[model samples]
Target chain A: MNVAALGAAELRNRLHGDGLVYRVGPYAVRLRSSIDQVLSAFSCLYADYPVEPDDGFADFHVYVHRPQNLRRWYRPQAIFEFDGKVPFKPLPFSQSYPFFEWGLNWCVSNHISNHLIIHSAVLENRGQAVVMPGNPGVGKSTLCAALMLRGWRLLTDELGMLSVDDCLFAPVPRPVSLKNNSIDLIANFAPEAVIGPRCEDTVKGTVAHVRAPADSVARAAEKATPRLVVLPQYVEGANAQLIPLSRPEAAMQIAGNTFNYSRLGLQGFATLTRMIDGCRCFEFRYSRLDDAIDTFEQLLVGGEG
Target chain B: MNSGTHRWSVLPDTVLHWYCADDETLVYYEQAGTTHLLTATSAEALRFLEYNEANIGELVAVVSQTLTLDVDGDDEFFFLMEALVEQLQKLGLIEACAH
Candidate 1:
């Protein structure tokens, strides 16, 4: 029997590239990169999502395929391809690349009503999603990696896709990228966590990815309510702290941090305003992962009372 | 050069708002957020907001005349007011009263 006969959840969707194949959740993705690049991008970046060894068809079936033509030309990003045509561009910069992570962001956002995609990381536990939104190098990935290891279910390390209808956020749990000292820090902090090999000399400094929790990966499709909207910053400080921010302030920050806020234009502004009004906003600063985790647990456990 | 009861500081350009207190003021926009406080200029700008809706051309004329400064060569006065007003508009503090 061929690999297709094995029954993969992602068979419904198919993507084709040079010689590699990708099974993005329920979709298939193909890339035109060498085996090394393909493996490095997916295997290393998202080690926790898990990939079944190929029976005899091709390399590991990937859900996301960053094309070779765009890889050299554009930023390191992921894409999700769908069976039917989409009204929006799949990649952040469609003109420069064509790749999508098989997390079904496009499908869910397209099908689900009242939910708009917000650029941030989402972690759900006990029906509550903690939204961490910020620009690059704000310690979001590091904090997310530490949270996943400590017990919070990893929703997504990037792209905190928020729903407008139910006021909930769905997890897109990709890989938690650790830069420079982060890899070592997590290794020493949580020895049990499975981390991918480190790739040296990238733009964001020497980088490696830490795997998400198995349970989170299993329930990747699940969506949770957004409780707190945090703008976390990894400052060299003595104590982890959370500072309250007003709705307008939060709105501006959330708007600034959004992936397609400007792209969404007026709709984006309205969605952002609604999101800020619905969720509590704060500025979090931390040095120790454990300290940060404790603070988050307190917030999540306390609920929005 | 003080002209009509223009409320030089009480103009419409001050329509947008962020965080304001006794001495500190914070302004937010799509581009970035800025904070202003008790400075003479900010006070004057805040006063300008009273007019409901005004642009740089009007604001420049008012400030230059009120301060008795050379209205023609002071690009700094015009430039600062224009940028601040743009940010104020972006923050929704002031809507385009023009149309």
Candidate 2:
């Protein structure tokens, strides 16, 4: 059953008690929290995710709790605990949901070694996936959200999980975090997009999350062969264009973006080389989402220029 | 300058992983954990140096013959080969033999 099927009281009970175990893409997460904001965020953002049975093993056990000190009465704060250990400093109590999302991303990127995780947003179109690798505030998430609204299936909004053996991208579809001005930008761009509550202040400025489409969450197990690697730059007022990149240049750029390339050693080199061999690479610069979408659509039909 | 006295050889214990596609070659140096893209001439020079260590003049002569360039008459070709050797040495891919 999906999380939406449960009544509010039951859902709250599950979260406050033994935790609500749910399947999120390739991993099962057990989330425990007494914070009302976190519960509200999960109820809205994760309503479509499947609720796993208690017997199944959870890949991550996470908790959001208020500190017990008198500071709770003065200035309340929320701490994120993973497997009973705190990995981050306490954030303001209002920032619980954003902290949960960031903490979960941290868990997957740091713990999962089987797949080569890259700090990129991945999406699929016509059975072909495009991996968009970029640094923070580069509009990677904004572009990803725009594409998803434009009928592209969201594979992931943060992690580009590439299988080590097959070089296929494993789907880890989750809420797309929109930071600062992009939150309002996406709201205006895709008026129909479902966005959760905004967590103001804290790190990364004000942050909000856009829920992944129900179709993407349903097809979580499906993987896609990466056919293109685009390093995107969202320059203001710049004309939208795709510049073809040499295989060697693309390979080196992808290696630099990968989280575990050095940790995986020679195996990482082999996997990346194989991916670069099959995909057309590009450096995409754009300011307009519509123009970017048109260019990418033409690319799919006509192949790289 | 005695061509027979100088030799060029790849650094010992350095591992290189190569990926060649459509006239482009990428070499990954295992020791440094760095990947580099090579021009056709540079790729050919490295491939030649992998098996045989040759002096600058000898390398220039052999590479000129392999690439079908007449370095004997072309000053640009001669300097290109000289610069290529220096570049490879700076990258730690090859070392000059001590006299």
Candidate 3:
């Protein structure tokens, strides 16, 4: 059963007691939280994620709760505990859900050694995945959310897990974490999108998450073939253009934006080069959402990208 | 002046893997876990050094002749040669060959 199948009282009861074990991509996460905000956020955003049995092998056993110190009565704060260790400093209690999201990202990005994890956004259509890796403020999440709204299946918004073994793209399909103005942009761009509660004044400014589409969640275990690797540059007022990159340059770009590429050594080098050699790489510059979405659609059907 | 006729050869073939794309030549040094995008001149220089032991002057001559650079008295050519040799040596991708 998925998260949407759980009753509100049952969800709360599970969270407050032993915790709810759920499947997120390949990992099973047992989340224990008495916090109402986290419960509401999970119910709304992770509604489609599959729920695991009560006693399964959970990769990450986590908690989001008050620090249980004097701060509980004061300006309460929430810390994310992963496998018995608090990995990040406490944020204001109001930011609990976002903290949970960030903590889970940390767990997966650091621990998933079997795949070449990258700091990227991935989406797919026509059985071809486009992996977008850019520095912060590159509008990766916004572009990903827009493309996803326009019929492209959202594979992932934060972590782009590429298989180092067989050169396949693993589908994490987690919620798209949109920050600041992008949140409003997504809301206005796709009013049908279900956005979770917005947390204000956190590290990445005001932030919110767009729930993964049901189709993406349902096909969560499917691995995708990366056909196009786009290094997106979101220049304001610039025309949408897809410029081709040489395979070597694309390989360098992938190495630069990766999370565990260097650590994996030559195995990573061979895997990345093989993947880039097969993918049609591009430097995508775009401003308008409509034009960007149109260009990708044309690329999908026309093979122009 | 930095050349000093010191012979250089590329690191072992097992440690270095080359991938040439449309516009770039990239090499990854597995031992150091580093990747480098080489210029045409740098690529030629490395290839020359890979199969044969050559000092900096020999490299400059071979690479300049291969790419047809104005090496007669060009300061840029000299600078490029010195910098390439320095970088390759620093990256541990090239070492002073035993005479």
Candidate 4:
């Protein structure tokens, strides 16, 4: 049964007790938290994800709870625990859901080294993937969310999981975190998109997460061969433009944006080289989502300049 | 010529990884963890020096033969070769061989 199948009280009981083990793409995550906001956020955003069997193994056991201290009564905060040990400082009690999301990203990026993990948003169309590597405030996630609402499937919003051997992109298909104005922009652009509760006044300004499309989550096992790598930057009032990049320039940008490029050493170098050799690379700048979407559609049809 | 006595060789103890696409090449220096983009002439120079150390005149001759540039009588070709050598040395990819 999926998380959506469970009644609200039963789901809360499972979370408060033995934790709710749920499937997230390739891994099973057991999340335990009594925070009403955390539970509510999960219910709304992750309702489509399957609930794992009671005996199944979880790749990560996570928890967000109120700590036993004076601060709980004063200015309440929530601490994130992984395998019974807290790995991060407590966040404001109001920000428990966002904290959980950030903690999960940290767990995956730090622990999973089998695939070359990149800090990028990955999307796919017709078995071809486009890897958009960018830093925060670059509108990477905003573009990713917009594409997912269009025809493209969302592979991942935060991490690009690439197979080291075949260079194929494995799908993670998690929620796309939309920050500040992008949240409202996406909501207006795709009125049907489901966005979770907004957490305001945190380090990243106001943040919200758009639920992964049901079709994308269902096809999470499928991998796409990378065909394009685009380094995207959002410039307000700028016309949407795509500039071709040489392989060497693309290599440097990919390496710079990669989360574990150096850790893989020589193997990483070989993998990145092969990936660059096989894909067309570009730098994309845009302000308008509709124009950007049109340009990408042209790209898919081999009509890009 | 005086150029014949100025020998050049790739720096010792440095592992280089290279990726070439048409006329452009990227060389990754493992020791420094840096990647340098090279033009066709510069790439040819480094590839020649990777296998054998050669003086300025010999490098120019080898690179010219590979690139089909008329360095035998072309003063401009000679000047370009010297500039490419200087560029490689500055990038720490090659060094002068002791006499």
Could you say which candidate leads in DockQ? 3
DockQ of 4: 0.46
Residue by residue across A1-305, what tens digits does model 1's lDDT show? 22234233232222233323533232233333332343444443443443333332432223344445765356644433344333333343321121333234444434433446655777877777778888888888888888888888887776667665555665566567678888899999999987766556544566666766757766766777777788899998658999987656666666666555555544555555555555777899999999998899888777755
DockQ (Cα-based) per candidate? 0.06, 0.55, 0.78, 0.46
Docking class of 1: incorrect
Q: Among these predicted structures, which one has the highest TM-score? A: 3
DockQ class, candidate 2: medium
Docking quality category of candidate 3 according to DockQ thresholds: medium
How does chain B score by TM in each prediction? 0.47, 0.78, 0.80, 0.88
Give per-residue CA lDDT, model 2, range A88-115, as digits (tens).
Answer: 9998888989989999999999999889
Whole-model lDDT for model 4 versus the true structure? 0.88
Question: Over 4 Å off in model 4, which ranges?
Answer: A303-305, B1-6, B30-34, B70-92
- Clash pairs for candidate 2: none
Residue B39 local lDDT, model 3: 77
Give model 4's TM-score versus the native structure: 0.91
Index of the highest-lDDT prediction: 4
The interface RMSD values of the models, given in order, are 6.8, 1.4, 0.9, 1.7
Question: All predictions: root-mean-square deviation over Cα?
Answer: 10.0, 2.5, 2.3, 2.8
- The sequence of per-residue lDDT tens digits that candidate 4 reaches over residues B1-99 is 344458888888768899997468888888777778888888998999887898777877888899887667777877777888888888888888876
